[model samples]
Target: VLCKIACMSRSRFYQSFKQKLDCTPLALQQQLRIENAAERLKAGESVSQVCFSLGYANLSHFNRRFQAQFNMPPSLYSRKNISH
Candidate 1:
């Protein structure tokens, strides 16, 4: 639907998106979700709240991805940033 609306083939859309953003759509989505989660966590929201609010269905998966992106668990990241 998005490709049709953009008047381009799916391949062209993906190519253009990658060229402009330097990341795949899924990668961009994950980065944005994690960044938003980090902000919410710093705003005093709980880890669970951030997880569900960001549409993650599994806590462990979210934790792994968050840790991979930020090099710490969300709880620790929140605490470390909040106390500074």
Candidate 2:
């Protein structure tokens, strides 16, 4: 469904998407989830709750990926830039 919506071949999409977006399909989803977490963090939501809400079975993994993408940790981004 997502592939169809994206109007791309599975293989081509995999390569191009990674090259353009810097992540796989699922990784992109997780990245969005990380952004959502960042928003919630700014809203004074707890990291643990955000992790669970994002359906992450491994909170540590989520943190690692989120940190890897955005430089600082999700919690830090929320704490520092909540107003923005």
Best by lDDT: 1
Best TM-score goes to which candidate?
A: 1
Give the per-residue lDDT digits (tens) of candidate 2, residues 1-84: 766778987887789888998879887787787888888888878888888888888888988978988898777876887664
Worst 10 residues of 2 by lDDT: 75-84
True-vs-predicted CA distance for residue 6, candidate 2, Å: 6.3
User: Mind giving the per-residue lDDT tens digits that candidate 1 earns over 23-47?
Assistant: 9878998998999999999888999
Model 1 vs. true fold: TM: 0.89
Instruction: For each candidate in the order shown, give its overall lDDT on alpha carbons.
Output: 0.92, 0.82
Instruction: List candidate 2 stretches off by more than 4 Å.
Output: 4-9, 12-23, 82-84
In candidate 1, stretches whose alpha carbon ends up further than 4 angstroms from where it belongs are none
TM-score for each prediction?
0.89, 0.68
